[model samples]
Target: MRAIKKVKKFIERSPNSTEGITFAKLILALESENEFPVIELYQLNSDEFDLAIELLKDWRIDCFYVGKAKAFDSATRAKNLS
Candidate 1:
């Protein structure tokens, strides 16, 4: 529940960001517990409460990681830096 509270704080601070909107949708899906697919799409958006708050406070809040992609050249995948 503490984590959920942190998530709420992040949303409150950046209510207009694309990430924030997606996160809001994810929370709705989670609360309904009947929209797993929608929730799945935003699973990666979840952030640690503390870190999420910091990102918001600093105004650098597009804080979710994108999925890794296959490397075009060598067979290695690109590492996620988020």
Candidate 2:
């Protein structure tokens, strides 16, 4: 939760900051399923860069679980409809 807050603050505080742009680009790259914006990570200092990576990992896991839950709910609804 602390990390999540930190990430939110990082983005909201300076959306146009170098770290923010790098983070946003990385997010876009992930959504596109392309190579990570590894080069952009260099824009951040070590701590910020590490936080970004950790946040990505956590967000990915959370998204996976949410997707799985939604699929389960859809399947259950379809089963009931039949």
Candidate 3:
């Protein structure tokens, strides 16, 4: 996955960005261009990816799926439980 490789390269180059803006920009750019390849690339490393997870917690953008999936799945399961 070249996209994943690119993101990894970016992270490697900028490993100390606590602001997460850079990761957000990468995500947004991929999404804006409908680049699923890039998007999935990011997802693969989302767990220990960056500070972007915190930044994207409340963001309305569709690019943040790291924490989003667990939250969404939990909600759906809870509804089913109820």
Per residue, candidate 1 scores C-alpha lDDT tens digits across 22-75 of: 557656754464453434344444354344444344332222221222233223
Stronger candidate by TM-score (1 vs 2)? 2
In TM-score terms, which candidate is top?
2
Off by over 4 Å in 3: 1-3, 7-63
Backbone collision count in every prediction? 0, 0, 0
Write down the lDDT that model 1 would get: 0.50
By summed lDDT, the worst window of 10 consecutive residues in model 1 runs over 60-69
Task: Give lDDT tens digits, candidate 2, residues 1-82.
Answer: 6555787777888899888777777667767878875777766899998898787887788789989999999999999999
CA lDDT, every model vs. true structure: 0.50, 0.80, 0.53
Name the top lDDT candidate: 2
- TM-score, every prediction: 0.42, 0.74, 0.28
Worst 10 residues of 3 by lDDT: 51-60
User: Which pairs of residues have clashing backbones in candidate 2?
Assistant: none
Q: Candidate 2 local accuracy as lDDT?
A: 0.80
